[model samples]
Target: MITNDTMQASSQGAQKVILTIAAAIILFATFENKMPGGMIGALGAMAIIGFVLNYIGDRTPIISQFFGGGAIVVIFGSSYLFHKGIFPTETADQITTFMKSGGFLAFYVASLVTGSIFGMSTQTLKKAALKYIPVILGSAAVACLLTGLVGMLVGKSFYDAVMLIALPIMGGGMGAGAVPLVQIMSGKTGMDAQTLMSQMVPALAIGNAIAIVMAGLLNKLGQVMPSLTGNGELIRGATAEVESEEKEAAVDLKMLAIGALLAISMFFFGTLLSMVIPMHPYALMIISIALIKVSGLMPKAFEQAAHAWYKFVVGNLTPALLVGIGVAYTNLDQIIAALTPMYFVLVFVTVLGAVIGAGLIGRMMGFYPIEAAITGGLCMANMGGTGDVAVLAASRRMKLMPFAQISSRIGGAFMLILATLVVQAIA
Candidate 1:
């Protein structure tokens, strides 16, 4: 028996949500032809677009079960919008500019890295460090070989297939993986930057899509074969007794704000170190944060704050960040134009190679095969930061962000170096 007041309040809430969405759309439309600046215009459009895609993905059955819901939807949907020219050029450009120069992706990664690492116990971190690096190296090697073999079978040259198809897919993500690889190739092979990007970007986009789908499939595999997963625990035989007793603090505005500051501060520290180290800021950040976590020096209050902030950001900002990726990073035209049976088969093989290699090595290292493949292998093959979140979500293992980041950042750098050497040898 619902009262009139309750019904009225429900109606009001629904109206508010609709009004907010409508307002966001209006703002996007207003700036359709103008290069809008600041978070208000660019981030606002992304939020609205991402929310709609997320909602649609969740309600859709096949997509939810097989493709990890909103993440895939947001990428493909935004790509569609851009492909059809439905999203105006100016609006799309604004989103891309913000994602790149405004450091939206950096901000998102920084928050997750800082919060997630601090929230974990020192013991789990230590156990993870022992076995994770092997999984990354093994996956990269396997993926490259399989993709190269498949390329030859499909009548393509081994170098082109490995460099253009396999390497990009396995290289981590766009900023850290594909973009840098393009520059390296252009310098060594005398290929135009645009030509190299044209070939590699599609592999990344399609590989990311497959990785997300494979994540969901792997999650299902875990259920059918329970022994193949640690059920969100990365370390084999790491007892849950200590972690189960740990309580999550009630999320509050103050705690969230504090968490935000901590995340940003750590990101700044990582950037500062990168000045001398010549590594990606994210790689430095991951190493620095892990040391801080393993050292047992962060205050409990600060740890809680980081944990709370990670939750808030992951829950609220993921879709927005994904929208930024689709608009700024994904090029639907390139992906579609590059589609062919051989290309498709090669991409599939690259992803499969990663899973097989990671699964085998992970089992040897005492990790669940399915979880290892998803985090260490698939996370590596997918587009960097956004792909990590999507694959983990699809596998229902958000707790593995630390390892996933390592796979993306450090592992990506490894691939870049490998590509450089390979090019030099062949040239």
Candidate 2:
């Protein structure tokens, strides 16, 4: 018989294997049912992106950052345009029929809801739903304003449907979640309903992918950015909103409970209120911040729960989200002629602009180069989504994790809102 320690080690190894197997099973089972086509395509896409990223990352960092996105845009955007007859479409009726189907509609909505749900980084039960508001709301508002302008410029009707994709890419895609708000203009009081719906689906897919990549790229940049956000974990007031190094210490049951309550309240209120207010999340964020503030008011305010709550509100959704994205995008080759060039232009200009803008904005707020750069990249990612941000952030080895995530998410909400407006106007 084996010694006691050997037995323990064997058991431990078995448990680890079991856990890995379980994780895989859960992932496939979830994807098999929830996402159409399957996760194979999704995994494939990630692999392709990863391989290309690896190669390019070693040579030209910035180029690698924007490389994959262009292809997504071309395939999805072209298919959408052809379906809508904006381009030379084959069997426009079929395209329309497929796009307008309930299955496609459900897919889009499910992805959105899941992305939102899985993205939440909270521990409290209630705070789960509320977590999506500020970002989404900001996304909606900014989208609306821009949409109105685009609509005004593009003659504002069904003919302008293709523009929705612009917002998704512009926001780095995760923030492109706001594209659904394009439906706002499709209502009885909104623009042509069919037109808006047609473009929104693809925008959701492509944009989210872009967002993921943007996140990655931003993280990569932080690895190379001049060190600046490396300040010590000073005695930050123990708030429920703490995102600093002390997050581990700040987590606890009470804070989690509070976060859950807040998230739930926000979702309930957001849904309830979306009916009445155009600028929906204004109240949501203000209230979330207020509550987050309240939770931190006492001694153990955000002690442990802050981190826990954040996890509940926004963590571990990337794989599924990406898989869903990959499954739907069938035409990989077309990406070259279709999406990359424009996406490259957009990302380059936007990054350059954000860098300049963040510098100005940072000076005003008293942050440093790395802090501002990471934050600016984060804004780009969230406005774009996680994939893009992740790709951007991870492009380098010594990435600034926290700053990149926080800033991108924060900026994502705002940028997406702007994107929505621009998209709606065009749609």
Candidate 3:
């Protein structure tokens, strides 16, 4: 007779086979244009496609070792599929509509931000706030200097290089960085905002792609030079008090629901406050959450719930979100149209400078070099909130979400101010 252990193994193997066959059937149906319609069809298609790409990337040798495994593959692969019309049109449109109009990206990030802030120790949070801005500044400074110098070598002016390429690359993302930046430059230089946008969009796109790859490389470098990283931790000498707390905290379905509600409520509050704050809703939400955490006002149960909710969302939805990012946000044609040897080099140098500058300064401020660089440098170079998620996920440092948001929202706001001054000076 078969033993209990053997019986369990056989059962698991059977379950896997059944799931695989079901997945194959769904995918085949999808390809044949017979998939279900609306949200079910869209989500099913994205989840299935994303899971397969993620699995391949994770198992592929070089990709698993250095290119962010499934995160990279899900993003780039989805983009390619969407571009080639391989994804069903109805499903693709639904995914895009869900990501953009349905507010899935914001919903996802709000959970992370709320949960992450609640999960951190007050001391670590305070220290990070103190040191993070300077790191962003250092990264931006070095990136601008390097990109401008390279621009001169490429027959472009220093101002154009810094203002057009470096600033936009480091300015957060398109809406927060390039759009307002174009308007500011237009007012200063008498050029149309649309014209300025055309010049800056390519730089933003290329820079974001480079930042993602660099995040993966940095993760690999951390593995090779373990001392330079804290694995997922940001602060160098900080104890794992949060992790211990998480282990001790009790979780249930009620707690998870509470956490979800708290996350969305904070986001709503942020939107309400934006009327008076003159900042991004995400920035306001972060500030609000940070203040609440620092004040010790929220109940311990609620905090634990929020953190648990965050963990749940991240574990279950990251790949799906990346799929949405690729199909909804990425522009293959724009990236290809902007490709040129000198331009690529300039973009690469800008991102490289950000990593170097942030890493060095972050180490000085008692943060792990790799963690600091990924948050302060790569986040700024990415496409705002979405880029932050992609980069942090690629680096396998999801716990650093709080710091990454600070870079995108707060650092991005700082860039807008800097652009104003630079435009006036250069124009």
How far off is model 1, as Cα RMSD? Answer: 2.9
Cα lDDT listed for each candidate: 0.85, 0.39, 0.89
The lDDT of model 2 is 0.39
* Model 2 Cα lDDT, one tens digit per residue, 293-393: 44544234432343356454323332222322333332333333335444433333333344444544443444444344434433443333334323332
What's each prediction's TM-score?
A: 0.90, 0.47, 0.96
Best-to-worst ranking by lDDT: 3, 1, 2
Worst 10 residues of 3 by lDDT: 239-248
> For model 1, what is the error of residue 144's alpha carbon versus the real structure, in angstroms, after optimal superposition?
1.3
Give residue 52's lDDT in candidate 2 (0 to 100): 34
Q: lDDT tens string, model 1, 293-390?
A: 88878888889899899888888888888788777767777777778989989999999999999999998888889878988899999998878877
Q: Which rank order by TM-score, best down to worst?
A: 3, 1, 2
lDDT of 2 at 134: 33
Task: Report the error of model 3 at residue 251, Å.
Answer: 2.9
Q: Model 2: residues >4 Å from true position, as ranges? A: 1-8, 20-214, 230-261, 273-276, 291-303, 312-337, 340-343, 370-427
Q: What value does the lDDT take at residue 327 in candidate 1?
A: 79
